[model samples]
Target: MTTAVAAPFRFFSLRVVRTRRLGPSLVRVTFAGADLAHFHSHGHDQSLSLFLPAQGRTEPVVPIELGDGWWQGWRELPDDVRAVMRSYTLRALRRNPDEIDIDFALHGIGPGAATPPGPASRWAARARAGDPVVLLGPAVADNRAIRFRPPEDTDLVLVWGDETAVPAATAILEALPAGTRARAWLEVPHAGDVQDVAAGPDVEITWLTGGRGALAEIRAARLPRCERPYVWIAGESGRVRELRRHFVQERGTDRRRVTFVGYWRRGLTEEQLRAAGE
Candidate 1:
């Protein structure tokens, strides 16, 4: 059920141990597995690939037995039979029980939905204890997948993320040292989607919901003066690009000091975005 995919990254057969509703539009699913004994991560914005069971299946179907060829094998499977893969952030990692928490951003999942829920959203909304899944995750700490790296001379940290990036942004904020000065903007669909983040007083968090967009709010506010500020932004592709430009070209921040990741696009599914190499 588990197989090594590459150095520092491998497949782990896991099952949902519990689920909690973090907000109106977010759910936290905790997963555990014996395979987690080898799992390791530095935790700040750690990226993970989760494989959910295909429709009408009890467990995910990933051709891990093919070893290094599993990617091609899985991709070749019929759409209805292949496992649904989605990228997620490591919200929290726990010891002793070898469990990891992944926060899901629900969309079109409940009653009165305006659009059909995607495979991942549907699965997470109904996920139950003992539901089987698989994860392609890190086996070594400090892996490249953790992308919120600030330079040693960083004096201030700026973060912006939509609901999709909330987990990563919160994790980054919580991981900051005591004296770190950080400001964050988290945007969600509904006011009920805003959740409490435990961070030091030096970290100021702004929650945007049902109103102004992140770019507009950020542009209207004045940032604290700092010689070297590291900016991390993630959300819709177009929005992320615009924010990156604002920081690099308008704000005069060094391009290297800004880390921007597009968690999703406005009108594209993750698969489509990947296929287009976005």
Candidate 2:
């Protein structure tokens, strides 16, 4: 008898203007704003929420100087501590009206050792070009049967994940829809999270070694050049529920053309909504 879990989307504000290092642990933090066109993002693996202050930082166009009455005490936080935000993924979304871009995935200490910094990698390692950041979210990824619109006569695409789902697997291979033909499985944490994944049409980049899972050696050698295909996996939830039960009940495929997302749940945090028994 429970069913009220709505309201978790709200945003506008980011000024970190720049911060690079696409590999060795992913940073990329460019942003600006004219309310960033009231923020509307719907790219692959989209999810956001920044709200990072407490540093002498300033400028995603300046907005975090709260103190005297501080917006009426943050409108009284207590919808479960106003839902402790910090769930990333929106690797990119543009609108030069002001500007915006974001990408972050860092996890520290050996096993591909790189992501050192802290406090969200020292606010993305002292992001300098501009500053301010506290944008909310683009949320919406209940995975709605793979959330359509990449079906431009597609027949093959099976992107796997890790390293917190490789920035939505390189923003779904840079929005693969025009001449879509996929095959990217990155299970990184090392080998510099294997770069140069700027794809578009007929992509087939596979890099896995985040620990022996190239999706069981690409399903024991080969079989998906398309027999009518569509598969989009995301990082660890027991290896995306064992490749959605080995490609929908053992290679039968067609469970609405497959799109399994599990952003995280290896050692558990939100634990992929408690293993989907949510």
Candidate 3:
């Protein structure tokens, strides 16, 4: 029996042992290591920092010399640049030999904000198994954040989010009490993006598209919700925040019952939103 080790900084360094493309927009990386054996699973809304290779395979530094000025450039990067860590959620974890699965939503490919090198972005493009990486959290999400909690008893849970936010929502639904009422709205970018998401019963799942009509179409008809039901929602800040206010203020639902969180703000990166959330 391996005793649990208190992780330093609530984060652990693990190696990517396997990679499976779950969907067109999702990459599931299975992480394993003794360090991760004691990994704490707080909730589905877990936010973790993932460090990709500092350099890509094409330009990977040889001889592995760190203090020889090769790493100086990155070390001296500005705050915004230095804070390039990617924020992700834990999709699943197992403790036999200790393993966890993290889902990464691949939105797009772009050059680094301050450099054209795009080491991290490009690194993700070709990421594979057996690569060593760093994971920096299991930090408990804010209780106020939407869908982060499961009530003892309740009405149906209403969860909604785009591809980027669905991982957290789906994980929450999986942890809900059996037979709990629940409903979900998944805004997948592509039809293929809705590959294998599973949630508990009492959930009316709806998938939307960005190219279609605005969410107002959905919200307008949802003027009324079931009784004693807590609505757990997350997505773009604009949409999730709107529904949050609607349920709490407009519809007169108790604030404590509903968990509303804007996982990502529009026109902002996950890192930025996480930083601001801090």
Q: Which candidate number maximizes lDDT? A: 1
* Residue ranges of candidate 1 with Cα displaced over 4 Å: 110-113
TM-score of each candidate structure, all chains considered together: 0.97, 0.32, 0.75
Cα lDDT tens digits, model 3, 102-148, are 77666563212233323444555566666766665543334222236
Identify the candidate with maximal TM-score.
Answer: 1
Candidate 1: give the clashing pairs: none
Please list the residue runs of candidate 2 whose C-alpha ends up more than 4 Å from where it truly belongs after superposition. Answer: 1-11, 14-37, 45-103, 107-115, 118-120, 124-151, 161-216, 224-278
Ranking by TM-score: 1, 3, 2
Q: What tens-digit string does per-residue lDDT give for candidate 2 at 135-209?
A: 655434343322434455557777777777787778778777666677777876677757776787577777775
| Tens-digit lDDT track of model 1 for 34-79 | 9999999986899999999999888799999998999999999998
The CA lDDT of each predicted structure is: 0.91, 0.62, 0.61
The 10-residue segment of model 1 with minimum total lDDT is 107-116
Clashing pairs in 2: 15-60, 51-134, 60-132
